[model samples]
Target: GIYLPVGLEKAAYNDGRTPIWNAEGCTTADIVYDDLRTTNGWDSSYKIDFSDPCAQKYIDSQARMFADWGYDFLKLDGVGPGSFKSGDNYDNVADVAAWQKAIATAGRPIHLELSWSLDYGHVEDWKKYSNGWRIDTDVECYCNTLVGWENSVDDRWDDAPAWTDHAGPGGWNDLDSLNVGNGEMDGLTNAERQSYATLWAIAKSPLYTGDDLTRLDSYGLSLLTNREVIAINQSSAPPAEPVTASDPQQVWAAKNPDGTYTVALFNLADAPASVTADWSTLGFQGKASVRDVWNREKLGTYRDRITQALPAHGSRLFTVTSHGTDLEWTGYEAEAGTLSGNASTAGCSACSDGRKVGNLYGGGKLTLDNVVVHKAGTYQVKVSYISGDARSALVSANDGGATSHKFASTGDWGTVNVVHVPVKLKAGANTITIDSGSDGYAPDIDRIDVQK
Candidate 1:
């Protein structure tokens, strides 16, 4: 629904032309219970065991194809919970690992969202492998209809902790596609939709539109394009915790990095509602300008309090910035240093350590030897590389710590191969290391630039 015209065809060639099919070749079948069988509630037909190397290989290939097609976000469905297989079952875990390997090898930045719920303990483990995973059964439509004296409902959106903690930057706990523009009776009202949007934005959930975008009306379009309100959700900083739901009609606030706060006001009553927050509760003691992100209007400056008239089931969002100020450049870098694959001169210069031999493949020990910074700020890091051998390399930032991001060069590197990491800096004292694990042919490191 995000307008991904790029489908499976182009993904097979790594052509950057369309959305890669995230779920490829994985089998699926309806669940059937057999009472005559000795086995309890288990059914053999619904099993999907991916630990088998053959199955893993197939999944890996599909993931590679998606990466090649420029599809970086994946939702691996039909592989967990109700979809479990019999003995030797490593379906979810193995598939995730395989996809991670595939994405790394392809040199692409991918966000994987897994279907079905995982064990609570596996949260950190999954985060280490993929960007995000779903923690519940598919989210159904929000509205429900009644038949006779009984209500027949098919969709619901309930929050659970099992998948919540796993959410943040580079990773998220998906709650499924948003039902914003859907006019179905089970669909939420305008205010309710606003609440849902505000919550998802604050949660940093993947912004997938469940409604048919082509048929969106003016109101739906306005909700989707409210840049001010949307910016809070798109803030670079990880999402903040929601203030406690003390009152059903009230929403709370949290502080962000740039002296700004993300504010949400909810309306739970049956009709229209209004609420206000004092500056003291938001941790601000001085005057601040309030900008309504939804309507994109300047609400003037307030020294102590702010008020809003939220329609029933509706809410408002604001990015309260200190009044009277210019845009501040957080950080900047001039040279990302030289990159090379030769281990002997790895410490000398960037290119001396690696070389670009071909568009699809390179032969050498890949290394980002030196990086110089001209300004200080938080920087997002990216590196490109290529390797044919099944070798994994360690990407270390500021020298080796217990943990560092790892990359594997797939057979091709001409595609948009990359990995991302955020680094904080002072004037200019940062170094990155690329240690190629004992592969016969060294990997290749291309350009390295810091994004402000």
Candidate 2:
């Protein structure tokens, strides 16, 4: 996600630290069903008691007042299925539903956005209520030079394609903000800034200027006024999908209303380099015409593939006719899996490329296909997971055998950890399946990595 400067009035929640309702009629008082309360009860966040009727009144009244004040966007952050829980994540569906009721009935149309990286497993829920939400952390954290400028950008791009089909007209993915306009505070070079803006626009993420408009430089101004770039981003079509997710370079493309494909080729590495997008990988049979969207230059058609050299932290945006195939990753969503129970997802920030699976139930089953490898050998298979408590499941790699492994707890959902299992992969493609194997608690899985 990009960066955006946002102003919010959170002080009104000063009174929310106390108990949500009186303990008079509550039998679970000592049970501590309060979602926001910590062991010391010092959490400053104003979490509502969504189970209480009065809480509904408070939410509705606040929403109505905001609407009356002519506010059109309300971002409900820090509210998730699992808010401050011992598990990978907790659910706060009811909490968001309450606020939605208040806002939708407020006699005005308001855009509802959630924040702090909601999980992609709740796509249906998010689409049903909020207009947009964040999938990655804020970009301004890169302001510290110690962190390096490119690290932040890389983190956002790594997971950009996980939700390709999740955005559209009524709502969009929030890539965060346009931090590039702030000059030095942006901590990015001109090329990086333009790339950042291009990535956000191409992803169909909501655009918010995070820098001070008064002090914006010519470079930032030029980027904002780039009509061709804005046109691609604002297009009604769905966001682009990743053609190359992991690499020295990443490529994403989408079909436009005019049937031309808008492609973004990114140099995600430190050194300047050129790369190629094979025609087969891009889903095209023949050659095509290409136009560079950013530089407004028309590059003649080519056969086989499109090759462009980009400087470190730079990119090339092209609108091409006969855009080739759009290849999807062998991710959890694309695999064959049996998901029992609610078939919901829990997510974490450290997951590889924001990958998530739908099976969290004990009896659930997941089958992954097309796991490519170079040679047949034993590899250390690492599964990314986050859980409030220890969890385990039966996992078999390449149909060799099943072994139960416990996924350790990470203290919080945002903090992620991995467990290693030994698996043998044959040359070329492989498939692995997982089933409930222990204590019946299947940890939320983000992705799997096998290393020699």
Candidate 3:
């Protein structure tokens, strides 16, 4: 769509705010001006105007020609319908019917898959027209060095749970492609890549290999081919969600036919964390043996819980006939926010689960919701953060009072730094806030941890 704005569509304006109309004068209020542009850009040379009948005939012929060419899967990228309206705009609905009808005429079972993040409200339309759709954004994820809570592959993990009902049988929520095998494109470590694969498998997203298959490393291959994990995915069992998505201490569990569960405990933080999954919360009142699904080794049986220490972005995917308790108070479980700027809940490199990113100066603040303390006492609150220079932040717990914490130079953006302050809190849910105190830099905070 970037070759030239005028070529995509004729309009009084080509900026994102203006509306675009087809030849039929079919204009939509729900669609932003940008939504009306060409999908893949294909250099703007061979673009189809869905509004034209001649274009419809061409699309039909193209579909039949694709069938003739023996291509089974056709991913029609960036085509949404007027039915999937944004705001008040009636965005042009591409001539998808032409493709469907043409493929039918060609007598081929060509599976249509939509590209980009289709509007969630149009799931039924997707199921009717395509075999799968991407539920997340793109896969150009920068791994841990990135800071936003919602980005690329990890965002898929966050979104999969909510769309479980949309996935089953022929229809699926595609988690894009596997970014694990690529060394340069993705920034995930080996363990993180393994976690990514495990998550995709558990969520039952179609396993499209985004990497060069011929050059797949042994470890990547192993992660992709682990039969037990694949069985859990292919079992067609329901997708798993976080029992408690406590950053650095989240628990994701799926039920099995044998009355067992595949529970994955993820440490989505920068530092190491000992996270536990409660048996009761997991719907098991008693105990069950926990076995590592990847290694095929028994981690022994436990009565009421299982807790494991995990590194940054590390995960433990295992099966249990019976198991234990997990962590509490994850990232962005914010009960409140006085924060300005784009707060990133996405895990950063070597930072705790997520950070509140904003110009946290001049009374700019980020409040972490539901900070729990065991007893009413003084505790040291540590904020894992990022900054290229030194700064200071004011903190308060449950409005008990405010304390100031100072941060030193962290050398680089990815070099995680920490600052701590002592504050008193009650035994229940308390709100802890960080405010910029110094005049220098407002550091990117990864997470706030209060220790008694």
- Find the candidate with the highest lDDT and give its number: 2
Candidate number with the higher TM-score (1 or 3)? 3
Error of 1 at 281 (Å): 3.5
Which lDDT values do the candidates have, in the order given? Answer: 0.50, 0.63, 0.61
Candidate 1 per-residue lDDT over residues 245-346, each given as its tens digit: 223345456578887777767665667877765454453345788888777788889875577887766678876776533322222111243434444322
Output the better candidate (2/3) by TM-score: 2
**Each prediction's TM-score against the native?**
0.54, 0.64, 0.59
After superposing candidate 2 on the true structure, give the runs of residues whose Cα lies further than 4 Å from its correct spot.
1-42, 82-90, 142-148, 323-452
Which segments of model 1 are wrong by more than 4 Å?
A: 1-52, 67-70, 79-91, 106-110, 117-120, 142-165, 182-186, 322-452
lDDT of 3 by residue, 172-263 (tens): 87877776765443556776787788888878887777676887777777887888878887885777655542234577787777778888
Please tell me which predicted candidate would have the highest TM-score against the true structure: 2
For model 1, the run of ten residues with the poorest summed lDDT:
146-155
Question: What is the RMSD, in Å, between candidate 1 and the native fold over all Cα?
Answer: 18.2
Candidate 3: misplaced stretches above 4 Å? 1-57, 81-94, 141-151, 182-185, 322-452
Give the lDDT ranking, best first: 2, 3, 1
lDDT of 3: 0.61
After TM-score superposition, what is the CA distance of residue 123 in candidate 2 from its true location, in Å?
Answer: 3.1
